[model samples]
Target: MKFVRTNKDRLVLISVAGEIAPARMRSPYSVTTEGKVKVIPVLGGITYNVRVGDSAYGWEGDHVEPGVSVMARKKEEEIPFMTLPCIGNEVIVMSGDAKGSRGVVTGKHGGVNHVIVHFDDEVLEKLMVGDKVLIKAWGQGMKLLDHPDVKVMNIDPDLFEKIGIVEKDGKLHVPVVAKVPAHLMGSGIGASSSASTDYDIMALDPREVGVEDLRLGDIVAIMDHDNSYGVGKYRKGMISIGIVVHSACVSAGHGPGVVVIMTGEESVLVPEVVERSNISDYLR
Candidate 1:
């Protein structure tokens, strides 16, 4: 397949940096599947074992985030850290044992306000909770000339080009691992802005619909979804595309989280499920 080209040169890239956040569990015991309460891992900090392409369920933890989690020091700085960088942007370890190691931004969790990054297994072993990292943030204000309604957000221009997207019959056909309906969307739906946080897919049962085999780093599409405005709404004939950033949650109205990368009207944007729709597969 031919690569999808866009006005990448016209996009202005920014610089954002932060430190690895500490793992936090709001309460000693938290909600699980069917309101069951238990103690487990949630978000923030560096995860030594889990990486992309891993399962999203059957973990002792709820809403488990893969890879290293980063966030700015103060509220003022956190805003840029959460919103500026796009998925696929370059991440550099600026401090600690993993100093100078390179990585890529994968997802942004809203409530926790942590940016997820994937590094090599060696780098993960070296990364610490307080280690600092910098992001070469880009792809915030990107435009697809051929399709104006399609709004591109937190996704690197280079990564977008690599996605198996083809313009067909006056519509943009996007290759995705799953096609999630709007009703299944749960937490982070009404966020102040869609650029910062990720929306969740309420998949209590792993065998649910199109997202049956959903895994971390997999690109999926949401039907009847519109993120062009605020956090977005459920409007008929709309489609939003995003990446599965975190693990499945046992909590009610919570599951694997997906960060929006692109969205537009269904008339011009189309999602097609394919076997190789994960970043792990695409990067390879």
Candidate 2:
């Protein structure tokens, strides 16, 4: 594998204003169940006690947590904050009580353009709105030396090493927290590319393999899935690897959100289940 680093002086520093509270759907329309429209917390700020690997707490729309979501200024600036940082990149607080504290970029929540970061419990307590953060942005054009068939997406080279991905018998063996069947995948599929957006886990059953066991930074495998450039479709022998970016949602076809990191056909990829396969564990 090869990674080319960008000029350090040109790296971008983004400033976040605050955490976004739960939003209510303006249209009085209902999809699955309804007392009110699908109301749930979307993005921004510290998620206090929630830890990666914890159940996204499906079905409880009002209280679920979206761990450590941060955003830059609205409009154009939000683009850089969302696109520059890759999974496993380091983030340092520049201005706040948590100034000088460091954290790892875990995932990005699409639509809201929020980047999720993981920090120590102590750091979380110290973080506040309007904190300035600098991202060392280096994971844009990475390549596998031996395998050209496998496509890489939104993953830093250093972080990719920590993911426990190994080469064996001409295929990449990836360690994941859980394996999700393609049938359970919902919203965001076929909507965006693996490079910038994420697909949702339907959360049809709370007891599903990756459903209850999933955490904010866990890496999971989606079987029979193909996301070459974000057009999600089913193809036999294909697998998609992704990072869980948001908490589970109560609405149908919505649950823990996962952004694509790596994908390949059967000839190039294979997924292995490993307990506690989360970003926090890898970084530690």
Candidate 3:
């Protein structure tokens, strides 16, 4: 809990199911120097979905190279405060008797901090586990103040009470969920880490993100930010967004819906007739 790195928006980008890299590279045995010194072959380390306490992914082992150090505790800012804004996407029920009861986020398994809310199925049959859920985070990256190209990322402002999309006369309705088209989307924008090494969307299919058309409160949109749709350096014209945290698996090009959240350049905002809200429901 003492990871003081505040920019407000306390970090929440869960993703882990498969695909990892760096598995071999053994080279160590040199001792001949008189004026030159060079040795390189580390090959491992740097798989941070963040895991240390609960275990299952963030233990800090398995890999981590770039200057190799460990004790970590350096953070001068960035923790403005974020307990649940979009702990996966908007939540409620602050105390007992399902205090407020309301949920959405369905995944945050980054090394076991736990955060997978859904509710319904009879309130998840009644709810259990730890039971606390009280998030609001606050209008995640809110935009529209002047249309910047319309870009919202990892939202969780209580998700406009469940989910609502609005665009008016231009087209782009909402409700129903699952769209994953725009050309499959896959490349690498800042490199998301479910575990490590992942970024492929070449022509997906699977009935266009299958699962009867993706559900569990779907919310996806990854229509090219750049890299043509796969190397992720994207930034031109910005518009790469995502949210469908789960549902869709067969592994061809893998598919369990997940992007938790993301935005583009300056944060993205360009409105002329775009008004859909669900950025984690006004940040709990």
Return the top candidate by TM-score.
Answer: 1
Q: Could you tell which candidate, 1 or 3, scores higher by lDDT?
A: 1
Give per-residue CA lDDT, model 3, range 51-125, as digits (tens).
111211112222112111111111221122212234344455555555566654443322212234444444544
Worst 10 residues of 3 by lDDT: 64-73
Cα lDDT of model 1 by residue, 132-157, tens digit: 88899999888888777788998888
Write down the lDDT that model 3 would get. Answer: 0.35
- What overall lDDT, based on C-alpha atoms, would model 1 receive against the true structure? 0.85
Per-candidate TM vs. native? 0.95, 0.82, 0.27
- The TM-score, computed over Cα atoms with residue i paired to residue i, of candidate 3 is 0.27
Better of 1 and 2 by lDDT: 1
- Rank by lDDT (best first): 1, 2, 3
Point out where model 3 deviates above 4 Å. Answer: 1-115, 118-133, 144-147, 153-181, 185-238, 250-254, 258-284
Count of backbone collisions in candidate 2: 2
TM-score of candidate 2 on Cα atoms, chains taken together: 0.82
lDDT of 2 at 162: 73
**Tens digits of lDDT, candidate 2, 58-146:** 43343233557667656666656666678877777887788888887777777566777777889878877667777666565566657
